[model samples]
Target chain A: MNYETPPLLRLCNISYSHPGTSASLLQDINFSINREHVGLIGPNGCGKTTLFQLIMGLLKPDSGTILLEGNAVTKSRDIKKLRRKLGFLFQHSDDQLFSPTVLEDVAFGPLNLGLSPDDARDVSVQTLEQLGLKDFEGRITHNLSGGEKKLVALATILAMKPQLLLLDEPSNNLDPATRERLIEILRGLDLAHIIISHDLDFLAATCTTLYTVQDGSLQRCEQKQVHSHEHIHPYGDYPHQHGT
Target chain B: MISEPFSSGSTLFHCSDARVKVIGGTVLSLVLATTTSFAVAMIGFLFTSLLLLISRPSPGLILKRIATVNIFTLFLLFSLPLTYGGADIVQLQYFQISLDGMRIACLIAIKTNGILFCFLALLATSSTVSLGHALERLRLPRKLVFLLLFSYRQLFVIHQEYLRLHRAAQLRAFTPSNSLHTYRTYSHLFGMTLVKSWNRAERVHQAMILRGFDGRLIPLKQPQLRKSDYLLLASLLLISLILAGFSLNNPV
Candidate 1:
């Protein structure tokens, strides 16, 4: 594909495994992405989420170069700077919304970024409003429903105004309406994003391209191939209603 | 899992500034700790009861908090009298309990329960975010406050994670048994929990770092103390002084 802008994120020769384990979880992962929405689909334990941790510098690849906007992310200091440009949404919203109240949680990033408390709060409020969560400001985070928690978690990241978003299972446990809302929200964002989800229809609605993880390697997936794959849902027949 | 369940109430205690509550509660706990007389402890108990009556917290929540604290307090009942080895206050054919030990134990229990009830009425009545803000306002170390918030958030998450794993095991026909297999299974479960916990912590740290979080956590709001807050603080201090005077005069 031809592009006018340089890739927002670039990974080269990335490989990693848990210490003392011989099997590599991710091997020779070469990838680059820009502002276009991308989807990552893979079976459980196929190193999809591990790739995200690597990009965020939570886990380091044994040998590789990761560049964010052309800056190296090998050192802790460099990772610190690179992270601000990227937002990672964990597979579990419970892991992300650590602050007591939705407003506090959303403001956490801005506060850490050295914005004054008032400014941080303003940004949080705006972000929550953008996500249609204006009434959740004083609500305790844990009291939120699963879908609400997901939106709040995303709001916390969006409050940072990141250049790129790394979303893992963004549609994991949402009701159909919430999933539709999430799809619309994802579609509306102007920033680049790499979303990992098993919900192919949801991904089809929001993502411009798709990649499949197989045996520790990422391969570009054809649109037609994605629809043809036979998969079984453990929770009865897949209930997702796809747009024609 | 302390519930800030009463935070939304329109009660006077709920509306009072968190900083005032924090400072007043600390001072009161200090007084409770220093009281050398049972009379002072009794007054502290009375104060706790009054606070409880006004706050009007769920009786079940209060009982739960007391039950949690009693786990540690119960140890004193067994160890205090035997360890002190003083003059026997209660003599029996098989064993004797020491008077000084008995006195110390009772005093410690009163002090603990008094402080705990005070905490429930003051600190627990406000949201944790407000409590964290109150700590920041009081100029407590920012890193310490950050750690406090981090732990508070993770406590429930870690607990729920463990419960989920336990439930998964139960679904797989696993049952608690006094056997090596059971011990090994539990050990593995604990080890997995620790690994998952550490991984979760690392991810949370990364997420925080992404938002420009340095080592210090900045307070999101700085609520101002109102006139009512000062009034409440003054009343609390005055009562504390009167209680101290009575305890000083009427020694146990």
Candidate 2:
């Protein structure tokens, strides 16, 4: 299938391996994210996160080009400009919330994007309030509950108002209510995002398309296929349909 | 439980601007460090103790902090006197404690306690994040300020990671013993902690870059100093100057 307009994000023949090692972590990865929330499911170390790093221009691929809205991110300046339009939510909320307070953390992205301090702060407050975290502005990040930290981390990304979001395991460690809140937030979002998670129910609820990584290659899974797949949990061996 | 002592108070020192508190605390510590006279150092200790009393941190916490410092101070007090070859203060069968060494040790202990009490009363009275911001506003190197902020946020994460790893080990029925395996297991724990920390740092850096962070972190709004801040700084400075003048004029 072909489209007249360029995709929001396009990856062309991306491959990567750790330096000084020949075994490839990601090989010949190609995907386009446009008008859909893409869910990525895979085992640990299956290069889902590497693909994200490549898209975000954090890791240099051994071969290929990353195009954000059809423009190649070759130069540092180009990456910087492109990065402003893309947001990445790390798997660990600890990595995302590095600022001393929630307000500072949320405002960090806007501040770096050249907003004035007051304007950045206003944006931060609005973003936090939108996420039902208005009171977390002055809260110390570490002192927050696990669920609160996850939302705050998402707020940091949303405050930047990116065109594309790359969320790594956004639903991990979230309670049912918090997870529902997150799904609601993601559903209401107009931007395209590729969310990497093991939570099939979470993905089925919010994502329009799904892909699973296997043997360093990405394969798209239809909604029916995703629901029928066997999922594992630490508590018991059970597989149930998500009914997407 | 994680909250710092005196960090939530609205006392005079706590209400003062962090920039003033940081500079005042540092100056007082420096003055105490440089005072050669035992009497002047004791005066500094007394001054810091008075400040601590006024600030009213938990008495238990203050005692615990001072006791922790005194463990190392006790080592210095006992050992330094035997090393310096000067006038004999105590002649033992195996060791001859020098008068100069004993005096130096006393001065060192006094200075140590003075500085610790000063920090507890002033800098520790406020949140460390504010202290970092104040330092940045005071023209401290941006890298240093970033380090402080990063450490303040990441240290807790690292500690939690460590505890998780330890719990995992315990779940596997691993117990510590004085053996090579125990040593190796501890080494592995530490090595894994470092590896996890490095990976976390890389992810954090990636998240930063994804949010359009260039090399430099943009500064937030500068804190405004209130009249009370100025008063606190001035009074602390005046008291330090008088003590300094007295110590300079009459060197004991």
Candidate 3:
């Protein structure tokens, strides 16, 4: 099968490990993603998170190039510029929701981007409204429900208006209804999104293509098409791409 | 870690801004320094209290918070008269109390009350973020200002963590009741909280770095100084000056 030429994010000969840690977290890894919605499924303790960070420019690969829209992201300055085009949601909602209120928290990224205060507020309001969180503007982020907090965290980055979004466990710990709402929200967002989740059904519904990480390497799975109907959840044994 | 909980957003705290609080408060404090007379400091204390009330802080709540931090001040207050004797104009049933000591105590109270009251008005009314914006407006070192801004950011998180740990400790089935085990548990928690905070700090730092947080506090759209703000600031300075002048000349 012929794949599309040139991806939104292309990782070439990428390898990374924690700077002070004894062992390498990921190495000899790479695959390009042009798919609008992609899934990165893997077991616990794998370098799934590290790889996401690598792509977000949170961590630098020890050796190799991470080219974003054809520009190498090795230097700190370039990484800063590259980051403006990417929105990242960490696994923990508490890590991202630092502002006193939900609206301010969501507006954080937009504010950092130097958007006019009025414009930032509007963007944040619109983003939160999309997540059914318009009523929670004055509410403190810590007071929100687990599911609500996750959505609020996503809104914070969404307000930044990034072209590429990187989400870690977008559906983790959310109730079925909340998770479903997340799926709907994901479906509505028009951008290049890579989600790291253990929820297969959530992934199957929201993503157009899927990739799995095994033993710290990223491979292109043959299954790139969305499941035909929403009647069944994808779990257990299915065709998975072997480690490349 | 950011310095304060909220950066300069449109919270109730930002109305006055930090520079006005810092400079204006400092100028107000000078009048207290010039005079030991009760009336002069008393007037200063009153203005500060009025500012605190206007900030919309519950009087009881603000007092309770102020009291907790005042334990050390209380200690200092009690020991102040020791080894320093003054002329005694009145004698109690058993001991003669020095008039000078009485004067000194009064002075201390006035000075302490004035400073604390002013600071409370500054922080509780003006958001920490506003203070940062105020600092930036004042043309301070940009690097220092940014460091302070980030430090202020961590204040919100640290305040939350302190609340969390206190709750967790309270919820634990057994209270240590001032035993070594209690001390050990508290110490353990302290270490744990530090480690957790450090990890969080690292993650936040990474996030900040990704956003091009060069060591500069970029102006969040230069906070415009409106006419009313200048009016209030000028009036406050005028009040401080008059109070100082009257206090110094009063032959009480």
In order, candidate lDDTs are 0.85, 0.85, 0.73
Q: Write model 1 residue lDDT over B1-252, tens digit each, in one string.
A: 545676768778888999999988888887888888998997898898788778888888779879999888788977898778865667767777787887888888888999888888887889886788688878898888877877887877788778888899999999999999999999988988888888888777766766677777667766777899999999888878887787778777
Q: 2 or 3, which is superior by TM-score?
A: 2
Scored by Cα lDDT, where does model 1 land?
0.85
Put down candidate 3 lDDT per residue, B57-175, tens digits, no spaces.
Answer: 65576677678757756765565544346666566676555677666766777677777777776654555556677777778777777677667667667766766886888898647
Each candidate's fnat, listed in order, reads 0.77, 0.70, 0.23
Off by over 4 Å in 2: A1-6, A17-30, A41-46, A198-201, A210-244, B1-3, B73-105, B215-221
Model 2 TM-score, all chains together: 0.85
Q: List the residue pairs that clash in candidate 2.
A: none
DockQ scores of the candidates: 0.55, 0.53, 0.29
What is the lDDT, from 0 to 100, of the residue A19 in candidate 1? 89
State the weakest 10-residue window (summed lDDT) of model 1 chain A: A224-233
Chain A in model 2: its TM-score? 0.91
Error of 3 at A118 (Å): 2.1
Please tell me the TM-score of chain A for candidate 3.
0.86
lDDT of candidate 2 at residue B209, scale 0 to 100:
78
The residue-by-residue lDDT of candidate 3 on A86-114, one tens digit each, is 88888888777666678767766777777
Candidate number with the higher lDDT (1 or 3): 1
Give Cα distance to truth, residue B61, candidate 3, Å.
3.2
Candidate 1 CAPRI-style tier:
medium
